[model samples]
Target: MTLRLQPVRLASGNDDSEAQLVFAGNALVAVLTHLAEHHDGEAGRWFMEAWFGPGYVLNRPTFASLDKAQDWILERLAEV
Candidate 1:
């Protein structure tokens, strides 16, 4: 099966609205990240999240911006 990272609409009742992550497939591979609210005013400190295999893992040293976060995620995805 091929892995895909497509934009998805956020469903209500979800905990992280600032960020959305969803995945489904037979191989069990996923990626997740968030623009945390806590870093709303912080500079050069953005909280990003990641989902590997069948679980979740947060990347260290958050990104500087949403663009950076997306770039980082894409880089990791390329490795998989």
Candidate 2:
């Protein structure tokens, strides 16, 4: 499948403290699974919520590149 890359960020109290990189697509399930396997449960859960929400549904985003996503996150971080 031709996949599109979208970037998402998770913020807690402020934009800076809890930021992450989220890859969206059919491939995201695989990616999230791998991340869950490698990272702590809390971190994985937070990402899942930000990207997939409570029902594990995809959220629409504007950016389509990893770099763009990271950049946006960093910019938000700077604001906090």
* Candidate whose TM-score is highest: 1
Tens-digit per-residue lDDT, 33-80, candidate 2: 112333444332333234432233355333433455445434543454
For each candidate, what TM-score against the reference? 0.39, 0.28
RMSD of each: 5.6, 13.7
Model 1 vs. true fold: TM:
0.39
| Model 2 spans > 4 angstroms off | 1-60
Highest-scoring model, lDDT: 1
Please estimate how well model 1 matches the true structure, expressed as its whole-model Cα lDDT: 0.47
Q: What is the lDDT of residue 13 in candidate 2?
A: 43
Q: Candidate 1 on 5-77: residue-level lDDT in tens?
A: 5454444344344443423353323333444354456533444444554324544546666556556655655
lDDT (CA) per prediction = 0.47, 0.36
Global Cα lDDT for candidate 2: 0.36
